[model samples]
Target: MSERITRLEEQVAYLTKTVEDLSDVIARQDRELDQIKRRTQMLMEREAQRDLDEGGSVPLADQKPPHW
Candidate 1:
């Protein structure tokens, strides 16, 4: 019974450590995603402005595909 209890405790500790590691990974990915989102938004805005400055009545993003 004592050996079983020790095994269970070891398993619990390992699982706890795994959970903490995964949580840290998730947090880091969240921050990276946020940065990517911001950069993408900035690039989109810049592209829109450039399209307007170039005298395009329809922004490229709003245009239909040539196949249509």
Candidate 2:
């Protein structure tokens, strides 16, 4: 009975460590995703401003496509 209890304890410890490691990975990925989103938004805004500065009456983003 003592040996079985020890084995169970070891298994629990391993699982606890695994869960902690996964949690850390998730947090890191969340931060990376936020950074990516911010950069993409900045780029889009910059592009729209550039179009306006180039004397376009309508920002390309609001203009209909050539096919239309």
Candidate 3:
């Protein structure tokens, strides 16, 4: 019937809008993730360089058990 077609059309319109909104959210998150990745890489590099500056000695985590 005509009413059923109208109801289906409305549902399709709402679904289309929801899809578009979700697509926008995903795009923004992608950009944020890229930025976070770059920052993490830079921080890691800086920390490594600092360790080299301080000394090349083994870190506590790498030391053998004290009972040895």
Best by TM-score: 1
Instruction: Please report, in order, the local distance difference test score of every candidate based on alpha carbons.
Output: 0.93, 0.92, 0.89
Q: lDDT at 15 for candidate 3?
A: 100
Q: lDDT at 6 for candidate 3?
A: 100
lDDT of 2 by residue, 1-68 (tens): 99999999999999999999999999999999999999999998888888789986676667899999
**Per-model TM-score versus the true fold:** 0.83, 0.79, 0.80
Write down the worst ten-residue block by lDDT for model 3.
54-63
TM-score of 1: 0.83
* Residues 1-68, model 3: lDDT tens digits: 99999999999999999999999999999999999999998997777768878987655655698899
Q: RMSD of model 2, in Å? A: 3.4
Residue 62 in candidate 2 has what lDDT?
77
Return the clash pairs for model 1, or none. Answer: none
lDDT of 2 at 40: 100
Q: What is the lDDT of residue 12 in candidate 1?
A: 100
* TM-score: model 3 vs. ground truth: 0.80
lDDT of 2: 0.92
